[model samples]
Target: MEIKIKNLTKIYKNIKVLDNVSLEIHNGVFGLLGENGAGKTTLMEIISTLLPFDDGEIEVAGLNVKKEPLKVCEILGYLPQKFDFFPKVTLEESFDYLCKLKGMNNSESRKQEINLRLQEVGLLSEQKKYIQELSGGMKQRFGIAQALIGNPKIILIDEPTVGLDPHERISFRNLITRISRDKIILLSTHIVQDIASTCKNLMVLQKGKVNYFGSTIDLINKVRGKVWLYNILDDEIPHVDLFVSLQDKGSSIEIRYIADNPLQGSISTEPTLEDAYIYINRKELTV
Candidate 1:
């Protein structure tokens, strides 16, 4: 299955939020990577039929999103970045409401489907828990569970792990990886770890434009020979164009940075997804 987008554009108050964005997303987990206000959320909203675009065509599984919005919604599941449920509602109650919204009129079918989705997301035992009772990670899992109610062919997830702790984020990433088969799961996030760990293919957006769109490994390779590891205690690192990441070693602060030339004491290091992303942003690297 594929979601085909061509020359997709969205404008808000005469400003182009998405400037002719185009993507051909296939089954499995695909990543939408960019910083805040990079138009990532706008693209997700357009694909999920939650917002309108000014120009271009989008076909979700060969169905035109504009021409057949309702049909597309039937096969599309959306977990928005700011997803929330009624705080007073129980998990079961939330599922019941979602099922009804999706037109699952049969009570027995809704019950069975809700149980299956809950079990798939590893929340079956907590179905009786109130919405307000779930932790951040649990809330995201429940969001996915609700998105799965209609057996959607395409699932658009926006910033799923924004406020989660380290452990919770990793757990949620594993869950995304586990269920990302036989369908298109488009993940939008600024966390490079999420893309490095979960996405096979990703598109990097920069200021409402496509900067890079290809395999994750290829993206990492973009910063090869530019990444360096320097020890601050021993010798000062050069003024680099991009500061990829830094770590504290108590006595010495080790910095992994990207630059055209390495310092005298610094050694060349392997590139990571984050390094590549920083390099792109620092230099405006285009595809």
Candidate 2:
């Protein structure tokens, strides 16, 4: 399956959320990285046919999102950043209802599919729990289960690991990576680590524009020799405007700084996707 978005634009009153954005995505786990209000969600909403655009075109699986919304919804599964459900519904009931809406005829097969999805998301044990009684992480898992009701060909997930703990985040990411082999999974997130670890390819958005789009390695290579590592005491740290502190290890701090000349006692460190993202955005904003 493929998605083509051409010259897509959206405006709310005087503010332009998406500015002539265009992209082509195929089957894989593609990451959409951007800061809050950088138009990632707006683009996803338009492509998913949830929100209309002011201009341009979007086609998913060769069907236009604007003209064939019902067709798009038939193969599209979307998990918005924040979703609400009936407070009194059990997990199994919720999944069953969504499956029926998706046109599942065999009740036994639907139940089996629901149970499989629940197990995949680590929520099978909580099948009988009410929506209001589950914890936040479990609720997010349940939301994921609903999105998988009809074996959607295209899945769009926005910030899938927003408020979960470290362990829960790992579990969620693992599940997503495992299921991405057979479908097109579009992931939009502010967590740089998630993009680095999960997505094979990524697109960085800045001021509603494509700042960088390609392989993660290529993006990191843009700042190859510019990243420098130095170990310094907390109080004796140098005052450099282009330095980013990657970590502080008690007595010694590992820092990444940008300088034309190599500093004494400082070693060169490889640039990561996070480093490239920061460098690209800072460069654009300053110019």
Candidate 3:
């Protein structure tokens, strides 16, 4: 499935949260990378048809979101950042209930489909477990399972791994990558590593505008030669301006930084995804 968002704009008070944003997304995972309030959620809501836009158009699978909202909703699955389920309901029962609500009849074929979806999310073994009994990652997987009930053409997942631990985060990312085949998976997250590892294409939003939108490798290449690494004693920490990150060594710190010119005794280093994000935003703000 494909989503075409053309000149989409949304206004609150007197400000435009989504300022004439346009994007074309096809099958596979497409990430929206930005900080909170950068209009990621606003744009997602508009595309999902949960909120109205003041201008422009959005089409999903050839149907206009505004003119044929119900048609769009039929093929759309959305997992917001936060959602709640019946705490006492078992995983199987929860999926059953959600499927019924989505108009799936209580038939043998429907039951089997539910089983298949749960298995795809690796939650079939936990089908009898209560919602409260599942870990954070499992709960998120369950969320995705429900979203897959009708095998929707497009799925929108917002900040799916924020509170997860490192292991859980990796597991969730892998799950997303596995299920993204043959569908449009629009993922939104502020975490750079999440995009770096899971998404091949990404858009960076700043102040409701697209700062960079293309393949992940091209984004990283933007600041390739401007990154450097410097070894410094603790006393020199306060003097560095473009320090991006630091690693603690026995007697010194290894600092990765960005600069327009090289520093004395510093080694040129390859730019990371985080470095590219920082560099892009810094340039946008300075301009």
Indicate which candidate wins on TM-score: 1
lDDT of 1 by residue, 1-287 (tens): 89998998899999998888888999899999999999999998898888999999999999999999999999989898867889999999989989999999999999999999999999999999999999888899999988888888888899999999999899989988888888899999999999989999999998898998889889888888989998887555447666766677989988777878777788998888888888777743321
Stretches of model 3 off by over 4 angstroms after superposition? 238-241, 283-287
Lowest summed lDDT across 10 adjacent residues in model 1 is found at 278-287
Clashes of each: 0, 0, 0
Model 3: per-residue Cα lDDT at residue 215: 90
Q: What digit string (tens of lDDT, one per residue) describes model 3 on residues 1-287?
A: 68988988899989999888888888999999998899998888888889998999888999999999988888989888865588999998888888887778867867997899999988888999999999888888888888888899899999999889999899889999998989999999999999999888999999999998889899999988888888888655644546578788879988787887867988988898999998888732221
Answer with 1 or 3, whichever has the higher lDDT: 1
Top-scoring candidate (lDDT)? 1
210-262: candidate 2 lDDT, tens digit per residue: 88878888988888888788887765666554666656789787767765575
Give each model's whole-structure lDDT. Answer: 0.89, 0.84, 0.87
Q: Identify the superior model by TM-score, candidate 1 or candidate 2.
A: 1
Report lDDT (Cα) of residue 65, candidate 1: 92
TM-score of each: 0.94, 0.92, 0.94
| TM-score, predicted candidate 1 vs. hidden true structure | 0.94
Task: In angstroms, give how far residue 100 of model 3 lies from its true place.
Answer: 1.4
Ranked candidates, highest lDDT first:
1, 3, 2
